[model samples]
Target chain A: MATKKKVTRKNTTTNKAKAKTKTPEETSPAMDNPYISASFWKAMWIICSISVLLEFFIHRHKHFEDLESSVLGNISNWFGFYGMFGLIACSGSILLAKGLSVFLKANEDYYDDTP
Target chain B: MRIITMTLLNNIPPAFLLIIGAFVLLILPARARKVGAIALAFFGVYAVSQLVEGSNVTPEFLGFDLTLLRVDSTSKSFGYIFTLSAFGALIFSWSERCRLQNTAALVYVGSALGVVFAGDMISWYLFWELMAISSTFLILARNNKRSRLAAQRYILVHLGGGLVLLTGILLTIHETGSIDFTKENIYQNTVAKNFILIGILINAAAVPFSSWLPDAYPESTIFGGVILSAYTTKTAVYTLVRGFPGEEILIPIGCIMAVYGIIYALLENDIRRILAYSIINQVGFMICGIGIGTKLAIAGVVASTFCSIIYTSLLWMAAGAVMYRTNKSKCTELGGLYKTMPITMVLVMIGALAVSGAPLTSGFISKTLITAAAEHQNYLWAWLALKVASAGIMLHTGIKFPFFVFFNVDRGLRSKEAPRAMIAGMSLMAFLCIYLGLNPGQLYSIIPNSDILVEQVSFYAIYIKHFDHVATKFQMLLFSGLSFFLFLPMLKRTRTISIDFDWFYRKGAKLLYSGIDKTFNSINRAAEHIVIKTFLPSLVKFIINAPASLTIMLFRPIWEESLSADKTNIKKREQKIISQFSSGTFPVAYSAIFILIFIAILIFLGRSLS
Candidate 1:
């Protein structure tokens, strides 16, 4: 290993930056994992409750108009019944993808680019 | 012009032409095969031109019963570009004439042509699968392990998608009793709409299913790469416009694919894979257009489709040319090539900038329509997302591909320019890009309800038309340009694989196989213990002891009584057992029963573990 390092070092014009890429073999205790970060859940809770509030207002409006999609096109199209549902659905899918990414995350060397 | 009315029928001309081309290549000499492919390209071009120039609401083929080959304006425009794509690829491949390559690629191109031209669903499906298989062999003809593996994977994916399509078609037929390819009103049931859309979306490289195109394309042979770029995803766009033009879900799906493809491309190392992802990115704009479902949006779809076909072919040609000259692929290993292969470097740079939507290029004229339509609707979030993605495109593809391959720090390669045939083909495409960009009116004429409306002055004309109101696109172009140069320091050639949708299947399959293997091994060990510890040894002991005891027992009983009772207990048992064996063959049956009892004891022991 030392000999291999010597060979590479001879080729490089400088030896300083090489230490950064010679990564530690095991866990690095200092680096924070984003999946476990407090802010992630905090962000999710805030956005989701906000969405629930928006859904409440939308339903109250839908009760007044009594139309499902309101084909009137501009102002009334703002708070249709489906609009609230669509936003909730979007949030669900986005969070699911985020959850999946965390569960499926691997070490930095996951797949080698060159065979 | 008089519009001709005729019955809905399908033509066998294109299919016959393809088969005949394959047969000629197989039997004829190599030179003849090259001539045959060129002639076929001209034949297709003439037919397509007639369809495009003629003024008609609908057209038909004469042979297949009631199957249509009608020419809607949108379809006619697509057919024109498909033919041109075939011509460009055919011209580029003229230098090499491997028999299977020629046969398969011609059939593949013809099959795509058939799909584009078909007016009904059944005929469209027939050519769709044909395109899949025929193009797969184009990859296989490269005859390397990687290429063969890639070919197999490509076929697997398309065949799987074909199954989904088949189920959808069967259900649709059962439900509607009509297989007409005219714009489908399939939103009657939500579940059925999802089934039909899933099948089409798979082919369009919508996020989860899109990895296959980039995964398979880089491994194809050079000429095969050109044809590979053109067909599959575009067919999905064709089907989308046909089936679900105004469906609301596609807007987000297309938006995701547009941005996802660009980001992955930023991480991509292979030149062709970069182009492949860009194909998805380019198609995203079209998909978004189809979602808009207005006349202007359809016009946007038309222009984007036309531009995508030409630019994609050009980009692939550039990659192929580089691969042909220097066998090295990774951008890190390639540089300083432009100084030697100046023609290649220049044509490729043109292609690169066009993909970036540089002004006075094909991309500039075509991509604006969709983004303009989005802004026209005041879809502020959607518009911002698309604009950011367009700029990202310049970062990933427009600069990375040509910049890395041609202008990177020199790696000492001094290869010559591409073959004359390749250069000529690229020149043809380059000329078309500039010509169309300068006079987009030529292309706009073919678009329904929009003709000769692409004057540069019209960009600032007081009208609210797309060409007039493309200020944001110009901003994207400028900002992307500035960002690329500013972030030049951040750019470096590094080898890395982006974890795409394929990573899920690849890594998940590995874990699944290991789990199943572990379960099977435990079951096998339990069975082995039962057989070894009890069944086999018990059978051996029964055979040996039974024969000896039966024969000796009779004599031992007589001798024991005479010899005296002194040896008593131990001797008595042995004598009795020997006498029993010597007496009869009944001892053998007794021993067999004992063996069966021992085997049952072993089974009890194994069961006791639980």
Candidate 2:
């Protein structure tokens, strides 16, 4: 009985030390609260869905009628044209930046060693 | 006394009043300087408001009729915003005790006002250089090695830019025999116009010369960033509208700037550098508008400048607040700050949304006007590019900034809310962003060419005048936000900085230094070797041996014949004589004979000449 008690005490102390030394990511309340994260993602999706749905109900005046008719056709008048364009532009910019980063990105101290 | 005071108020430009106030700040207690700055800024606004629509002060300068203060719709609008931004920046920095920065801030503001109001090229150039010099102290006030280096580079670039501007002005003056800073005088000489355009574009942070903005601004003292954001580029835009309206080149340049800013901001890790790039992006929109140069486009540019100054400063202030509380600036180092600094997070969101041109914000109203102008002008590519940039703004500043700073995965950082003064300053700008956005008519009324904007307002009856514009912008920005989350993994912040045009100066400067060292210094080394090592020693040896050698040559023939049987004895004697001459112990008669010989040679030459 005495040996078992000692083992339990040692285990508790080690567990406490582990908790104490946890990384910020592990200790963060937001990280532990899965419900909040889930709800936030849900809210984001709902908001985005409504925005896309509103595109169908709302009629957008085409700024480039000639170009649209000649090349893009009615694609610009589609329900999610603005949304898709936004998506493509944003994603394209990020991807392009990522590609460029291979050449352009440098260590944070890049300018520090320089005169 | 009353009459003198009234005359002084009427004759002295409001800009000069703020400058005088800056000197006054020097004498006041450290605590009082802040209040003094705010009061002076308010007084400047009132003085600007009271001015009539002509040159307010004309001073004779070196036989030139200098217009010290000129008031027009454009200058008036710029003047009001400059003073107002000064007031806001002063309030934000109230807690700061650095008297030099406080004084420099006031002077900086004063000189920016001076640039807008100056009616001649000379005074404009003077104020422009003063603006550059005074604003540099704001960066140096950080008093760190990095900030020091950044300030040095900032001043050098501005001085170079000022020289270019002065060259342009001098050329324009010579060509026209007038110093008036009018479009007619400027555009009369093509070279002068191009020089002036390049000068202003450098300040405007247009592509290649733009790296200075991001390089220096983020390194500034926290409050300095807020003040720095408001004036320099906006003043350049003001000048562009005043001088280079309808220049077609700015259209392409502005497009490239917009796209460049978006790409860089996407790659930047520092929160403040991202804001700095967005300044370029926002200025690009205005530059594009100025290029359009229609009455509607000009009005849009002016209105957008006013709105951009407020919103961009707001964003800087919020970032500064975060930096102040946590002493961390990189987005990768910060996360879940909303838990501790909710007020700052909210203010930043407002600023971020406004910058993104979200619905019912000041950006929405101002940014749409530019696009509307582009569409009206049938520049389909510019319109499409601008729309893409608008969504780009949403991606970089709107979502990326706030997300990485406040809402990303928790980093377990904690800090109290920003100082009350910061909050108050931010709230003031935030209120204006929303206020001007909700009621853009207030801003439109103050903008240059207001009549055209009003006409367009009625024409677009579908824009802010209706809900369709709102819906369209909403659909675009929200979808952009959706894209942000979908690609969150790709947008991960790393502890890295993206190379910019400054790479030429930052890295290329060292390359240049080494190149010069190798070329010039090596030549210098060769010259030293020839003169000191080879030439000097040989010349000394020849001079020392001259008299002895002459004696030896003269006597060697006689000795060789006389001592033909005793050649060894003659050789020993000759060596002894040469040693005596080198040791300065030779007979005086030989030196006398040599001097005589030199005199005889001179006499012979003189005889020949005769």
Q: Which one wins on DockQ?
A: 2
Where model 2 places Cα greater than 4 Å from the true spot, the runs are A1-25, A28-36, A66-79, B1-10, B455-465, B519-610
Name the lDDT value of residue B441 in candidate 1.
Answer: 70
State candidate 1's TM-score: 0.70
* Model 1, span A19-109: residue lDDT tens: 3343333323232111112454465445444543444332221121333343432332343223233333323323343344445344435
- Per-residue C-alpha lDDT of model 1 across residues B397-432, encoded as one tens digit per residue: 777788778865556677889999999888888888
CA lDDT, candidate 2, residue B467:
66
lDDT of each: 0.69, 0.86
TM-score for candidate 2: 0.83
lDDT of prediction 2: 0.86
Poorest lDDT segment (10 consecutive residues) of candidate 2 chain A: A29-38
Looking at chain B only, the TM-scores across the models are 0.80, 0.85
TM-score of each: 0.70, 0.83
lDDT (10s digit) by residue, model 2, range B109-179: 88998899999989999999999999999999999999999999999999999999989999999899999
iRMS of each prediction in angstroms?
Answer: 14.9, 3.8
